[model samples]
Target: MSWYVYILKCSDNTYYTGVTKDLKRRVDEHNGDDKKAAKYTKSRRPVRLFWSEPHESRSSACQREAAIKRMKRTEKVALASRV
Candidate 1:
């Protein structure tokens, strides 16, 4: 199964990084009232897709997510702009 490392720009203008197998479903959950959604995103509704990268494995996707999470705001913005 394909995995994805995604960056979401929350309604609050903050970024949330995560790894998911179904990007569409995950994004929908974030925007919807699903309890499965991340707690951090639950309050910051209406998040927008800022950036994403495909990965062959969940491990890689998770690793990338961690790396992106460690990135400074400016670096993350640069990454979003690049794609």
Candidate 2:
């Protein structure tokens, strides 16, 4: 199994970054009724997957996610558009 760092483009135009093992299911949870869904995206609802990168381990995926989360919105947009 592989770990992945993912970026979501929220309905209100904000970006959310996180790590996940299963991209499809995780994306569904973000838009699902489950309370465990990402808090930042729950209200923003209807988040679309903007980017993703696979990593060999959970640690690396998490590190990348954190780095992406720290980026400014313009930087994030640039990153997403580049790939």
Candidate 3:
């Protein structure tokens, strides 16, 4: 399965990083009115996808997500712009 590292711009202007096996479905899930969605995102209500990178392994995707999460907001925006 292809893993994806994704970044979402929350309604509050905060960024969130996560990995998923199916990027579209995951994004839909985040937008859905489901209690299972992460509380952070659930309240954000709507999230705009700012970036995505496909990876051969979930571990790699997760590592990338962590790295992106560590970046300052401006740097993260630049990284996302490259996608």
Q: Give the deviation of candidate 1 from the true structure as CA RMSD.
A: 0.9
Which has the better lDDT: candidate 1, or candidate 2? Answer: 1
Q: Weakest 10 consecutive residues, lDDT, candidate 2?
A: 33-42
Best by TM-score: 1
Ordered from best to worst TM-score, the candidate numbers read 1, 2, 3
Best by lDDT: 1
Error of 3 at 70 (Å): 0.8
Q: Summing lDDT over every window of 10 consecutive residues in candidate 3, give the lowest-scoring window.
A: 31-40
Angstrom error at residue 43, model 3? 0.7
Question: Who is ahead in lDDT, 1 or 3?
Answer: 1
lDDT of each: 0.92, 0.90, 0.86
- In model 3, the clashing pairs are none
Output the worst ten-in-a-row residue range by lDDT, candidate 1: 28-37
A best-first ranking of the candidates according to their lDDT comes to 1, 2, 3
> Which digits, one per residue and each the tens of the lDDT, describe model 3 over residues 1-83?
89999988899999888999987788888889586566789989698888898999988988998888889999988987775
- Tell me the spans in candidate 2 whose CA falls farther than 4 Å from its real position: none
